[model samples]
Target: MSQLLEPFREAYRNMELLPLLTETALKKFWVEYGTETIEELEQLVEDSPSGDSKIIFAGHRGCGKSTLLAQFGRRMADKYFVVFFSISDSIEMSDVNHINILFAIAVRLMEEAEKQKIKIKPSIKEQFYKWFAKHTRTEIEESQAGVGVGFDLFKIISGKLKADATIRDEIKQEFNRKISDLIARINEIAAVVQGASQKEILVIIDDLDKIDLGVVRQVFEENVKSLFQPNIRVIFTVPISALREVRMAGTLTTETNNQIVIMPVSKLFKQGERYINNSEPISEAIAMLTDVMYKRISRDLIEPEVVKKIIIYSGGVLRELVRITNQCCRICLRLIRRKPDDLDIKINAEVLQEAITNISIDFDTRIGNADYELLQQTYQFFTPNDPKEQRFLDLLHGLYVLEYRNAKLWYDVHPIVTEILQRKGKL
Candidate 1:
């Protein structure tokens, strides 16, 4: 038993002593690195209560949307009645109709309101609970009993409610009315609270872009548009790809048109820019991001050099930095058995080279049929000095693989990804 304990103790101590290669626990570290965006979001919520505006936060995957939401939640908790919801984990958002998404938003908000000790009128709360329960029941029953009962019930409800020409129209109108009424009730509560304390209500919808692209469009273009109100401020995360999809769909409505604020991750990291009106240097931005990664991993595996490598690889994307750091740390742990001294902990160029090679190979395999073709095209058309080369650099920047400092002068791909590409002969 003592022998076994000795090994465990040694491992723990080694972990403490070792330099971290990557960020493993990003959510916790986010508190330190997310100040700029959190402050901006707080300001937006504060100012939006007096006007009608919407903020659409757009970034690549792993760009710290969840972290931003968590930090913003904390910042707004004191003054605003903040309700946070993330749809990334829900399968319904990917496949089912968006009614479930609305129901989810209401349920999450009500729960949050309760947690915050906000006194919601009992009648409104009860009605909302019942509506959510019924909606959930309908969804479950439909899934279990097949579409026959669901379609029949839908038709029955439509027929009974219809004073219009089509059952479909009737059902749509009824759903819309219920949703509107719910939003109105929420507004009423917000208005009363604002009158009392001059505070506002913020509904933070994180991971909006993580859902199915189609559902995202439906929610923003159709459902969410109707739900927007002056007293209610919404901050939703959107993928850059999804934004392009929205633009392509031509579904940008009047309500969503000018209200859309593309809050790029780059904006928060800009040099010398204060939250209110200042900018931070590139060095400061990198340092903050490194601190964030260090905190996330409990300072267990990442070292300063590794953080620098991750920052370079991340192409100025916070999320990418965190992810690459996390991955590298995991790789390092798997490779070393008896945990060597400080020398062993250092993630040298070789380790990074290996990681990048594997990643590039994985990417190539993922793009199977087009791997060779794309590589050839990339090599032929991608001249480092050409303007088109800058576009390619931008593409890599968008992918969080490389950062663009100037025209065609770009840094190397993340050590991990670069290694992979080299192994695959694509570099």
Candidate 2:
């Protein structure tokens, strides 16, 4: 699978490597990257004393939370009616709020229930059709009123809700003044559906973290109670950096009464040790990351040591790791285009360094003097002086600062950002 001879396959593989949002991560690059984190989440969900567990799954943007959550949701399907969907597919990130979020859940609930062919009373199903039709301003004719019709209606309306701004705004206005009513309706629908399906409802909402932090603060901080009012188990994703805010973290923990579960970035080195101290990275984590590479691209395309170097530069973020390697592939592809007669088309030190230089420029440009100062201190101390400062949090959000979990939570500058600092004489 060298992909060099097959232009179409090479293009498809290149697209896969870009840092895009996808649900088929586990299906494709089936790495044992975060099974421990998934197992922990399973216990948090399945074994909850109160069945209505609302969990906040926080992690770096590209830390494989979606893949882990996909597996978690699949495992839950046997006993619970699993409703896994990305909020980005429903509402525009800028326009998202607590009201529209619950609205999306209710719509998705009915849609999934229909797909699963759950036997709900016709009256309850009609109520759902009418409720969605009323809020979304769509008409559901009485003649078109069976499971097949209801499924088709919701399918069309779901697309409109995602692709149409008018429907989203109408629903927002209809429920914005009295969100409790929205919560009540959701609970009512969930109750009937659960009774019919004979399983508890588990809603796993992804992509909520990709929104701006300000918007996340509004939906999560201002209306956290409303978010949990539906009486169904739910999992909400938030930026790992958002938890750095003491009030936000304190509020979520206080409300949930449990520790917030964070999917950690892959821990490469031990705390307070880098590559220089004769200190090796955790072998298991490194192997997991390397295994991920072997699955995607052949080892012949890149050297083993080169893959490890790319991983270190990736700061253990799966998306970044794939992206840097993808860059090398594109570099080699360009060279072959210029001269396909060359026998050796593999990625070499020159190509790998070029990839590093290309990605570092992006990080180098977004960072500022203040961010650099914070990075330098974080590099030296392995912790930010003011972890709660928005600037520091920005670094965390931007992946300029990476948080690693081993014995404790420790912070360090991202390897790419670190190299930039060294070149700038700041480290």
Candidate 3:
């Protein structure tokens, strides 16, 4: 085909929907969208000279929280012995709670120290290893398991912790009643690591937010104090919907000295604007979202009109922006394959609409009477006044609604959801 259009084939082939977890992917696609929030978080830890510093934060699912967190970990690497991990990688999301979370943290801390060769006394390592074996029901035939031998065994136990339901339930059952015992173990490990490394331990627990809201309420609202009792500095993430709940918000701020650090969706339009104004100044947030798209593909492959509409429809959620554009690229490539002679074909308005319609259809299946009723209520004013409503919370969790922050925080139905609601005469 022609040289200009040939690049589209390569760009479209390289799109991805998952979070930027690897070093190389992040370097290529990461943009500076949440500088203020990250700075505020950094300040929170730096200012806390004594004891543990725990910060609970929230963001919408696709708002680049995971990617931003990777950046944060890299930023804080020199000052703290950073151990960052997502909860889902270790435990099942449906079974996640504070107990398992602490369990995972302890496991990860040792794993990290071992991987990084951070010096801990051999006696301490052996003690921690035996404790893990006892809790995981792995018996030691040998009286004394060497540190090297123990790590190899612990890897097996760690695999069971992630995959075997029986072990998870047993650990939860065992620790549920004696939470102090578990926290004591966590604090002990943290203290040992900090003492050995000469830096405070910072554990960034990502994707705890992806669990059910009821469990979130139980974890943060009721048991938050227990989660923070460990000596290490920790960052816990919740879904943006969980943070908006009245009781959850109050408990977090009141119990913890620091306010929740929110990674907000980049706003493509002014809070009050109904439509994108061509002559208006393009906000930095909008540029961040668009740049995320252009970074993955050649800008010439997709029409500017298509990109603009996708941004608005994305509702400033980074995942949506990537997903929609990625799908558009996929559709364009498939069409090009169907008509191999068409060198003029690119991602056009029709391709954009096709991708949009396919996604809207998926949302259509998920929306119900309760969701639609809540959507009708908050379609215009997605205020915090009634943020505790379960239906509204579900909408936020499902991304049927998108939340944004400004001088005042507000919400709106997802652009695709809004169109669906309008067509249903609910808005």
Candidate 4:
């Protein structure tokens, strides 16, 4: 690669593309979606009484759920004893059941309790271990025969809970049989934590959205009450794809005092007789996203128009925007190696177009004709019934269609999805 390309490549390599977690990372990587969604969610939680409360927040997988939830956690940390965790990190997401969720939360709660120097009653600890030992007899016996010297029972239990499917199933079945007991034990610990901390326990379980649709439905629909019946303030991050499959709207509304919040895509357009790109919101969003990359990489590596094009192609999906930007950097690296002039090397329009074309190929494979028609209709009419339409949900799940909230809500097809269909003369 030419010398000019070297600096650009180096800068691109240093860019932070992963999800933000730390306070510093969030400060550096933040982008305002310019909606009252976060405040509204906070308000609901703040206004509610200090009893068992659950809020269901759904968004597209990469549409900034983790970062937003983390932010929410920080905002509530001062007032609430927050236990924020990502479930997919520990459990089998595709096969996750309500039992898996409960165990994950229990493990996390135990860890946070230890961190905060809050002690669980010895009787409660013994009760928890007894429950574990009774349900996981085979696992305990196997571990005893293998590595029994000074074995920490809780450690063994936690490992088996995450790794052993049979153990997990047994615990799940036992919990199902004696759910009331399990609920009582959870409440006992929750009471202790709340009493010790002098604040309500706010359990923010993130990444339930990453699980399979079947698992999502099973945990949230078939057993919504079971999953959410715990006596703690809970906020679950659910996937946009599984939103329609969830059948507990009324139940969740009544239970959590109606704190369901949906984080929509950043508004990039104003829908009317003709779909017009709303320059102001679109520019502000693009500029903020551009800053995310520029914080690590030099903006000189990318042309301004190229950045705008990439953001447009992303269709306000923050993850997609960063992903395409990363792809462009890679493509630029390869192209720079073959180019004659080092100074001419830059992430230009052609490089972005090539990157988007590659992404469009994948979209083509995943999106079906019905999804295409739904996206097409969403692009044109912005129909009143569109949000409720099942096909519309399909398109949203596929990321073929994007949702945005302005003075009102609207839907539009991802620009890359639209571009590919137009290229094939299908639009």
Per-model tally of clashing residue pairs: 27, 0, 0, 0
The segments of candidate 3 whose C-alpha lies over 4 angstroms from its true place after superposition are 1-14, 139-154, 275-281, 382-385
Which is the leading candidate under lDDT?
2
Better of 1 and 4 by lDDT: 4
- Model 3: clashing residue pairs? none
TM-score of 4: 0.85
> What tens digits encode model 3's per-residue C-alpha lDDT throughout 319-345?
898888878877877777678787677
lDDT of each: 0.49, 0.82, 0.80, 0.71
lDDT at 334 for candidate 3? Answer: 77
Lowest summed lDDT window (length 10), candidate 4: 142-151
TM-score, prediction 2:
0.94
lDDT score of residue 238 within candidate 2: 93
State which candidate, 1 or 2, has the greater TM-score.
Answer: 2
**TM-score ranking from best to worst?**
2, 3, 4, 1
Q: Model 2 residue 158 lDDT?
A: 81
Q: What is the C-alpha local distance difference test score of candidate 1?
A: 0.49
